[model samples]
Target chain A: MAKRSFLIPGVDKRLLIKDSLKAMPDFTRRRFIAGGASLGALTLLTGCDVVDSSSAETLLAQVSKFNDAVQAFIFNPDALAPTFPESAITKPFPFNAYYDLDDAPDIDGKDWKLEVRGLVDNKKSWTLDELYKLPQVNQITRHICVEGWSAIGSWTGTPLRDFLKLIGADTRAKYVWFQCADKDGYNSPLDMRSALHPQTQMTFKYASEILPRAYGFPMKIRVPTKLGFKNPKYVVSMEVTNDYKGGYWEDQGYNSFSGS
Target chain B: MASLTVTDEQVGVTPAKVIQPVWVRVMHWINALAMILMILSGWQIYNASPLFGFRFPREYALGGWLGGGLLWHFAAMWLLMINGLAYLVTGFATGRFRKKLLPITPSGVLHDVRAALTFKLGHDDLTVYNYVQRLLYAGIIVVGVLIVLSGLGMWKPVQLYYLVMLFGDYPTARYVHFFCMAAICAFLVIHVLLALLVPKSLRAMIIGR
Candidate 1:
């Protein structure tokens, strides 16, 4: 019929007078049905303030885990992430972290030790000078972040595969878990295949200069293939193990194998 | 029971032709569902680092946040890819693609464009796809394929380096994916309007009567 006000049966009639402003039911019914379903599904996924074992959060987590396995299977270690020319380097490379810049862990180079543990023949920790001396190489590669931004930065360091070999790390292990000095204990697990990538490095310098405090000083594992978060910074200890220890963001629903 | 027993052909009555076969109808509904999930979740993912300036409203987004958006996107991606592959394979194997969307000519499209603009386009014959429908249906197929490729390129720039290279780079591939989504949304508006304008076509898609 025509645009006009209508009443609900009884209890809800007074509360819904604003509904009279809407278009004809024939026009708006389908839109409402579709929007309602979407809103319903959104609430289903997020409305539960408490995430338990049997929740949709767990279901999505399981899918993320499945994605990790798919990524591992599809990962070709020989296929390298494209490297850029020196000129292509993103000037003043963006500094990204869960916390603000001034709060980045401040550590003295004189006191820091790269602790090595688990499934490695060499349990000895290495000093910053010792890591700096390991046959160095440089690469300008794109750093892709999960937030959908990317930057190219030149990093100089020894390949993680070579360093792992030098440290006598067991290659059979599934992951190289890095524990960082960030106040929130920000950490990440590096998959073995990615850890062995030719370009993956335990970086010591940025743009031929000593790594700065703002850019994870002491060291940052530069993984070009994976999303930025997978590249843990200010790493203090590493354990080569079969265990899948959840990470800072990974535990909060981010996919563990966030590589591209 | 007698009505069911008596054949339409034997009784000198024309049979109701099935314009969309059972498989096509099944796959069409599935594709429609998957497309909605993908587009909604993708909007949220794009909002994370939008290429252009404006953002899709949060209420319109499917997932609650970035992480949730990605989960929904990846989940729907698998469904879309599988269903899409099945559509292509069966369509090609059965010559359905050739029958429905072939012989598309520039002149025919222009004529249809003129007819559509002036609101003179006819939908009396549901079985014979008009030139506009053929062109749109065919063009959307190509767009669908490119969007998936670009999505893959963005997803695995390293493992699929060669694929990403075809689109120039990661950010460029993101642009292609975004434009493809835009094209699909455009098509959806027209497609839905036509279905509404010709309600019998919508009935055929649903009940296949």
Candidate 2:
């Protein structure tokens, strides 16, 4: 006698159903499928239509946006990333960038001015000295890379929230975009909540020394809560805007709001 | 429930009751799918830096690239967490934990180990889980919790400092998470092997017989 397959057929149909449900734009499907939906129910919802790869990608992107909204909604403005003791800082911190250390841009600090653009009352650029004059603070925090390694480093700079306030930027803006001085025009954007986090800094120094060329000579935004890539180095300009200006990696399908 | 019990009068075998419920089987397969995707995508992500000397092969890894792997990892992470949580809650609330998994003793575990090592373990009765099965199930539950906590620590080490501290540090937490994943993979190997050897067990899990 031939052996009978029991659950395999059902499992395959269920997977197809799940795929169709995921492709649907309606949020009600989630609620309806809360306790798990049957194949008949899924077919009824999607009309048994096949979702192509492009449609699947679009659905996935929508899901990612939904995740971002949920994360932003739950984020606490006052909550701080953990700060470590000075001794805990990783020595000889590994240099990470899209390019080699030798390729790091040699910016002329004396001639350079931090450009302020977009929705800000004051459009005045700041010299390195002027940025240094802002109330400075220090933090020993971990820099978690997207790739699996992590390192602790001591960073010092002006609080980004204070700087935004001083610049008379609209705090209600959706994103604070960074334009890097790197050769590739590498950049990233931060949501309002992460932008205003206490540890988010317009960093100017590392381990009591002036920010080295390898670590963004003029300035870097130290956002501890986000993955390392979100902390765009070699930052030359900043823009406060409601428009969705995607980042370098973000445009390549990496999550825009990469907050932990 | 009574109809599910089976006895062989001619062979003089005792009656065996159905062990897996429909919900248990559903949770089992969902968890299996989530774990498989997570492990595969996690390997793809690990290949980005590699704590060890070598990296996982592209063909063997899921998601194709680092960005794609991250998307898969984060997506499946929610599935694993939510499904695992529901399984835990249901297991405890429905008394499945107390009735089927708990009350394990050192002596009972020792006896089961001896029985297993000596090849004296029997599968004639499928109603009750053996001491070893019970212990392994409990151990996997503990490891699952550790994996989630360590993953959280790695995900938001700064925000979830206490979880990071639980495993000594961030690096340590990463190592813990990796090893837990390895442990689960090992369990899966043994589980599938045993299921093949005892085909009825597979049928029970699938059909809740």
Candidate 3:
């Protein structure tokens, strides 16, 4: 049999909605109960939005609390940034906003010095050449950006531990501070767990070549486990510290614990 | 009463009720959530490269985690697809699509268009809805389907070869997905405003009499 399609003219479909209700003459007790159950389900779904919003807030709070616990434990006077192997490199990293680095020192390679100070037994400033004379470390690792991008690159630099030992890190210092030449004046606060990860370290090679100066020029701090913003570039000084501190992006609304 | 003009001949109008059944309402709210999640996660993916100047920090995610964003989007997409299809099928089988939701006639469309434009021109007790609401609802349904189809085209280019061919290429499919999202966002803005303008409209959908 050929089906005749239902067609209505000049009346909005919504206007005729009541007709559907009228057709069900047996709006019995069971139907009412079923309808109620469905309505309850509808209400529950409506509350999902609010539930999702609160759960997100709770997660953020927990992350912050975890960072706080790490901050409370104190032991070593100085810590070193971790080193990585050269085979695990990533590519195509982007420079973050350097809103804090505009007015800093020019850091000419000739006079560049990495001042190691504060809470250390021996506060000393080592020239770039002197610092480079130490054991060099290299690693290939992903530079995950806080802005949602990832790049793997080979980085070459002296082991931060080598620098710490040279300056005679005391038992009181627990964190290392990086003072960058880019005027960013960015300081990173790291827990011992991340500060000494084997895959974490400073680097100067990218894509199997000398690292571009545009990345950080003379030298940069590389913490592979954290977001790229935490890896300060054009680093001028490495301060050993027992006191807690934060970096450029951290102050401008970034996670201090920024780890995997 | 007749002298006082309370007669049916004097007014010649009757109110027609609009009922958004439990199934339709549940499906609607779920669809809304899924779309919102898809958009939020999409923004996360887009932030990887700011095609425009806008940027959202990777740490800040709608789902509070970058990985969670992707998971929720995919999960919600499946739910929306299943529920949407169910709505369409049940709507048809129960004859509700034809009797209450379908607009298969030219005059029906014309009346909707006219009523949509001239808000106050209809009789005071007219139960018929103007065309604008139907048009918007129909648009949401159509665009929703397109977005899902285009999404599949991107999700599996080789498997969904026919769907991808419809859009010509993968990038073209992405464009369709993006524009459909824009349409949904636009509709939402207008829908909310209209709801505010006519307060009883939203209540009617939620607590139908």
Candidate 4:
């Protein structure tokens, strides 16, 4: 058996002799004063009712200037959020909401196609199977909600950027619009910066299961960096354009640029 | 030791005239505690969304802390607002406003900016405030007000009536609230760093100069 030894700072026994020689009156008095001051401050915090209005107005004015300065400071052409490893994901996510799938044309794989149109030289439609054949990207990210609940899950899909590249997305295009099927009028605008986020993919599988109807079955969109509302579900068709047409939430007054 | 001529009531040095009046001190601590609680509860709220791909859905459940966190947060918020208002009143009535928190001129701000860029601080004569501190303190107050207004804009859109148009609507107000909070977090990072950089300046607030 091994014996363990640890270092500890032991109190010196000579403190009693030192204390006897020191000015005990001053020491005790100072301690008492300090204790009293702490009590007084605490009392002031709980009992006092004395906030000055002038300070509020002055502080308010100073704060407004600061807000302007911040707005001026944030001028950048391009920036992006990072993607995380799939291993960090949570599995078997509970389905909360789904949208725009019922109106999807129930054509067979050969006939079913996603149309990419508006503001692009090469407009084309790709079949769902064709989309699945493309290079895939998987990401694990937390989905934040406005109602204040969050879920972490693994999403597997092809990046929207890749699809846009395949269609030769016009250089002037400012927004990518998703026109979905279930027809509860689901659509959203994805700006350039967010459209190219590495984690911003069109998701198919939520966990290991193919998406359920309650969770945009078959396929859906996922925008990791923004709020969950930005990730429109039951995605059917996509349109890339420079003009900002109102989407479902945009019409409801959600921010058009909800980048994290 | 030989103070025969000196009276016990010798008033040569008045204890450093209380620069931070009782009201100011009360408001400071209340605001501090309230802000901290808000952040913690806000996190529990944020936990549901984790805005930037961070989530701890089971944290509160695992730790048994979510409910208490929310209660503390809302309760402190009320205290924060009341104390903040009280401080505002005291500042105007006591005329302690101009005495401390002197106005910073553009040139003074410019010099402070340079000092901040160079990581120098607390040279009171040369630099009024390291630019970052002035900017952060100033920004925090603005963000705080925005949060309150935007929160109202969301919760009582009908009452604030005019805010709906300014911030867009409920969802937009939510965005503003979230964005302002993000700004606060950014300020907090810098604030903690500055606190570490200059200990005495941080102490001045607590010890009343």
lDDT of 1 by residue, A180-247 (tens): 99988998998898899898999989999999988899999999988999998999999999999979
Q: In candidate 1, how many Å is residue A65 off?
A: 3.2
Candidate with the greatest DockQ versus the true structure: 2
Off by over 4 Å in 2: A1-56, B1-16
TM-score of 3: 0.45
Give the per-residue lDDT digits (tens) of candidate 4, residues B17-123.
44344455556767777676566666665564455677545543211243333333444455567666676677667765444444646787788678768766454
Worst 10 residues of 3 chain A by lDDT: A3-12
Every model's DockQ:
0.18, 0.31, 0.07, 0.05
Off by over 4 Å in 4: A1-88, A98-111, A208-210, B1-209
- Share of reference contacts found in each model: 0.46, 0.44, 0.07, 0.08
Native interface contacts retained, candidate 1 = 0.46
Best by lDDT: 1
What lDDT would candidate 3 get against the real structure?
0.60
Error of 3 at B113 (Å): 25
Better of 1 and 2 by TM-score: 2
Report the error of model 1 at residue A54, Å: 5.6
Give each model a TM-score.
0.84, 0.85, 0.45, 0.44
- State the lDDT of candidate 2 residue by residue for A1-260, as single tens digits: 43323232223334455666777777867766664555354223223222454554554566577777776576565567878898898889889998899998899999999999999999999999999999999989889898879999999999999999999999899999999988888989898878988889999999989999888898999998899999988899999999989899899998887776
Please identify model 3 stretches exceeding 4 Å from their true place: A1-106, A165-174, A204-211, B1-48, B51-209
Worst 10 residues of 2 chain B by lDDT: B1-10
For A1-260, candidate 3 gives per-residue lDDT tens digits of 43222123223244344444445656564586588896575445334454566554444444355444553453221332232355434334554554433443445677766676676777767676665666776666556565444555667776555555566775346777777755536667665545555545555555545556667756777776566777777776766677777777666545565553
Index of the highest-TM-score prediction: 2
